[model samples]
Target: MNENFKLLNKKIKILHLIQHMKIGGGQKALTNIISSTSISFEHVVVSTFNQYESELNKLNSSFIDCEKKNILKIIREEAPDIIHYHWWPGFKMIPKNKIPHNCGIIVTVQDPTPVEDIQADIYISGSNFINLFQKHIDGKKRIVIKSYIDVREFTLKKKKNTEIIIGRHSTIYKNKIPENYIKTLLDFSLKAKFIIAGDGESKIIEKLNLEIIKNNAQNKIEIWPGEKIKEMLSICDIFLYITPDDSFEGFANVISEAMVAGIPVIAENKGGNSEQIIHGKTGFLCTGYNEARDFCQLLIEDRILRLKMGGNSKKRGLTFDHTIMGKQYDQIYTNLVKLNNKEKQ
Candidate 1:
């Protein structure tokens, strides 16, 4: 830890209110923040759902399972210096009058357009798109804090593979997958192996599998569980991500993770995807599937180009390192506490 970071270690207690501890971008982001932040700050994570209780225990902070206890009771019991909500639904219905006067409320907007009516002392957005979208909200200090991950965990020694691999991983919602997703994979099936990893609705999974079978691409495309994200990234040479034209991503963590693993990405030029990829340098952003296919084919044919872009991608990905994000968050928490104390006095 830097000596400057230690100055902000005032043992401030932060109570994180989240919807669940599931394996999603928001949950992972929260865990990374808790793990990377200075140990001087105390953390207590309160989850409305307890699907992955074991994962919550892995964090350095304490955990509160709201399934078994009341959130209001837990908040009063913790009486933290800061009450930080990870997403909108987490703090939606909580009464403002019930909270302690000295406690500061911080809401990190994980989605592009979250419910703006929710009151908070500070509103943190993960991307500029979200920050700008919510700029009209009244009476709150808004700031942009990009999401981060533990870059060290993604650093993997590459091994030689028989075929060029293109991969993408996500929670796999209908809107998250492009409409012509199967056709796009079939186009590249002869040249590269495709790996789509993630858990989603059974209907979506069934539809994807049926399409693969219908197109006789069962052997070319492989669908893996979301838990094997690290393994998938290690074997993949290129990261290809595409979502529907109408759908938008707040800040796709998978793209950053793939980049950190030294994989060049070719993502759809929509939402925050444009912000993550530096076109023609780190990776190419496509306006449509045809453009994405061209970019993917370009990298597939030129191994040297792939390596060069991958190196650039890794360099750019380091900007979202956990330590850097942790420092920024530490400063934010420190400032909020100071402001709250001044008002209280």
Candidate 2:
């Protein structure tokens, strides 16, 4: 048997270190990876903040509460063949000398900003735009492994009502919910029902609510808690996403989720949104709120065009499915382990 095949026959253990198990892009990415990876691989997730105990149980993997115990102690005890760090803030605090040399280190860059004070054998980015920032990180290899979603979970269903539902889902940070985007949604408030779903800072939520009230568009625009994303996408005819001119999305997993759910996406032409959306095909990428409004109106007016774009979106979205992501990670793990073993000899 080939050396690589021999290593693959045995179980490969991956220890995932994350800042928190909270409901966010990074946590969701980790969940998709763990759930989709091959049975030949075993996963153990460690959360630094120890939030979401119930969510961790669903992963079907061993969990370590970092708040209760030292991470180095857990690392030594688990002795993972590969240590994968998501976001990597948790790894910054750990002493480099304490980490076992035998295990390979992989860091997934979840944010657009360049990371510092962290060393890894491999650095994985979610998009080409993010990979540009990771060029500064010295690694054996820097690769783009786009964030993924489980497509089976998203259902492509027919719209039940004539009401045009425009939706956007995110963490609801102030920068994410831009004042200009809010104005754009208000522009079409009468033609469509807008739903902005996600939990975030209370002050930001209040500010949005106040804007809706000031415009007297509360009935037209709804602010929902960020749960049941599939249900949200199922009802929405179009997924309209916008951030401030300055702020940029790393990958926008919500856009991919909406695309797979068979909804046309109208996102800002910034950051990784350009990569996820194909202009005028899978969806439209707008330079400003005016272009977004124009695209939104076009989709709302033409049902056939909307469905056609949606169909295209689903076809393109499957390319980022979690299974594909798992295979890529599996290859990375196998190659790294093989290389590490060779170095030992």
Output the number of the lDDT-best candidate.
Answer: 1
* Per-residue lDDT value at 335 in model 1: 79
Q: Give the distance in Å from residue 94's predicted Cα in candidate 1 to where it truly belongs.
A: 3.0
Which residue pairs in candidate 1 collide?
A: none
Per-residue alpha-carbon lDDT of candidate 1 for residues 1-345, written as tens digits (9 for 90 to 100) = 645445545688999988877656788789888888877689888886655566556765788888899888887788888998887443464545567545888888878876454567888888887777786766357888888788998887776899998899988877688776887778754488899999877788788888989888877898888788788998999998888777777788888989899999998777788889999999998877778888888998999999999999999988778898898898888878877777887
Q: Give the Cα error of residue 262 in candidate 2, in Å.
A: 1.1
- TM-score of candidate 2 on Cα atoms, chains taken together: 0.90
Q: For residue 206, what is the lDDT in candidate 2?
A: 85
Task: Summarize candidate 2's per-residue lDDT along 138-173 as a digit string, tens digits.
Answer: 644688898888888775675576698998898887
Cα deviation at 113, candidate 1, in Å, is 0.3
TM-score of each: 0.91, 0.90
Which parts of model 2 have CA positions greater than 4 angstroms off?
1-9, 49-52, 88-98, 138-140, 180-184, 188-190
- List the candidate 1 regions with Cα displacement exceeding 4 Å: 1-10, 89-95, 98-101, 138-140, 188-190
